[model samples]
Target: MTRFRLRSGVVGVALLALAASSCASDKAGDGGAGTGADGVKHGPGVTDDTITLGLITDLTGPYAPIGKSLSQAAQLYYDEINLGGGICGRQVETLVRDMSYDAQKTAVAYTELEPKVAALPQFLGSTTIASVRDRLEASGPLTLALAWAPSVLGAKPIQMTGTTYAIDVINGVDHLVKDRGLKKGDKIGHVYLEGDYGDDSVAGSKYAADKLGLSVVEQKVKPTDADMSSQVSALKQAGVKAIILSIAPKQTASFVGVAATAGLKVPVLGSNSAFAPQLLATDAGPAFLGDFAVLQAASPLSADLPIMKTIIAGYSDKFPKDGLDNGVMAGYTSAMVVGDALKKACENKDLSRDGIIAAHRSQNAWDGGFGSTMDFTDPAQPPTRKTYLLKPDPKAAGGLTVQKDNFTSDLAAAYPVTAG
Candidate 1:
């Protein structure tokens, strides 16, 4: 196996300077005001003093830790922005609701927040977001989804910050073949959740397998399924050289632990949501550190980038006791996207729903000082095809270290994102 080290440069300073320029530009005038007196066309959830956004997430479910971290980081970002002078001369206020990871609850939360917010900054859960997307398309507040399945990209109003689940898996498989000695005709097992998240991951694995002359052995499980003893047994019996996991952190802990016990010591690659920092405190931590690597579109909180310093400083000041994780970066990045769009809308003097959507689409090359630059112009495709491969490390920030920075596999770059 080849070791890859983290590299840092002056990119963070450039991104900050650009952000400062954008903030300075906002001083020209409060652009998103109502047409009554300011001659500006304002949208819903916008007042002269405030701009409201929504966050519907899982605060009391299986993904509670990630949800909480994501929401906290968003709040931290907005707080910093508000203190620095606010966007469009208005303070950003977030309306938060916990859906407990249930689709029905998510629908209810969306119904409640749809009328009051200008846009949604963080809507978590793959299935939950899909349930309320029909309502979003008919109405209009542009929404940023925490989930990243390609299937959910059909709605114009909904957008994702990073690449899709399938893209990450494709890159991961490619990495295994190129760096980890995986060869053609070797069997790679995938244990995935049975919804959009897992299905999309499987799609990428299959695509890579076909191109690389490898075979994928799949095992599908529901969100609630945690014990991976059976799955590991099956994969071991199948003689898989590597394994892909597209489930949550709990399943990740279970799978790695079970695999360790079953002597199925193969290279394990996971999706973005697969591993959480909290997992490092468990008995499975060693297994995760040794054999598992996760692919994600965002940089971890411990990254050496200058933007991360800002994010981490703000988060530490606000939530001193909160454990650090990639969720903080994910949440802050999502807020950056929303803030950028709002700034653009304000500049256009049209803060309406349609105006916000138009402003967001204009960001063809958005660099948030994390991961890769994204292109938001095309709704049919993912924002970017690049992903980072990270490994669990107790000494690292967010309990993970970058093994490969902003990587785009040839197979991943060529794979077309198709909506389900």
Candidate 2:
């Protein structure tokens, strides 16, 4: 198992530098104008006619495939919005930065972006978000829209547009247990990366096991673990009824492939982060078959959904070369949420940080183009706690098939506290 250790002071310095540049650009007479409380004109990226939104992604990091797709989707949305006369007579512009999936780089990128943009639409990855949590909280009034699950818990000025890390895993487990009618004391095996991401799932699985009367057996792996035979062999010997995976695409696919070769046929369930269509298609192939399930926070990109159709058309028209993925949908939805908040802020012609924050919190039943609905009336709470389950499509080869649509039945009543 590969453990990532980040240098704190270096990340801080990078963030400080980025923030200074972003704010510095907001100096006198750039373009549009709004006066601050001190009677200073609104900075460069902002104008009376436009709002600049910032985005940070791991464009060249381990998660580059997902990051590139997300950035393309966000840019496409901006293009479409602008073409349609923009929001409330003002166009939306996105400033994107590549964080290279490094915590330090992500911190520096956010620092550069936070002061210039009206809001941060999407900050990708759990580790990246954690690195900047302190700075975000201390930055005062600057909020970020996040795509990572852990960011939902105890993260303020940052709203997650999906279920919390622990909650989503629990939801997946609950579905399997209820559907399969697994008895109390049924054995469940978990394979996960040995970091914050993996730890979150382990915690969630334990909670669900206690609530639903199942017994959990865990196997921890490093992010760089390419061989999962040992773990799969252990689980097979344990006679586990089911398996839950909490790792990235490469590792998850490896485990699935190895388990299949070892003749272990138990149903496998995974967190939302595990659903990478391209990776699954290329790495695991038909080996995954019908034995895997994934959680989705956004609506599926199936051509049948109206919102998805629109998004695909927009993306294809604007970003012809970049293929769509779940992260693309996540990025688009994040921007849409920010757009909603901006619309509300414009309604009152008050663009203060406090005003935008209030507007976001008051939002309820927001349709975010994913199966789940969002309600963020409490800033200190998780925004969306609903998730949809997806199964690997045996017939379609590489694609995912939706097993349940809008599985939000438990979200409203199950989770009581905001994640932190």
**All predictions: root-mean-square deviation over Cα?**
8.3, 6.0
lDDT of each: 0.81, 0.68
- Model 1 lDDT tens row, 300-392: 777789998898788888888676886788889899999999999989988888989999999999997775799998888889999998888
TM-scores for every candidate against the unseen true structure: 0.90, 0.86
Q: Per-residue CA lDDT of candidate 2, range 329-369, in tens?
A: 77677777777887786675655565666677777888755
Query: Cα deviation in Å at residue 218, candidate 2?
Result: 0.4
lDDT of 1: 0.81
Count of residue pairs whose backbone atoms collide, per candidate: 0, 15
Q: Pick the candidate with the highest lDDT.
A: 1
TM-score of 2: 0.86
Clashing pairs in 1: none
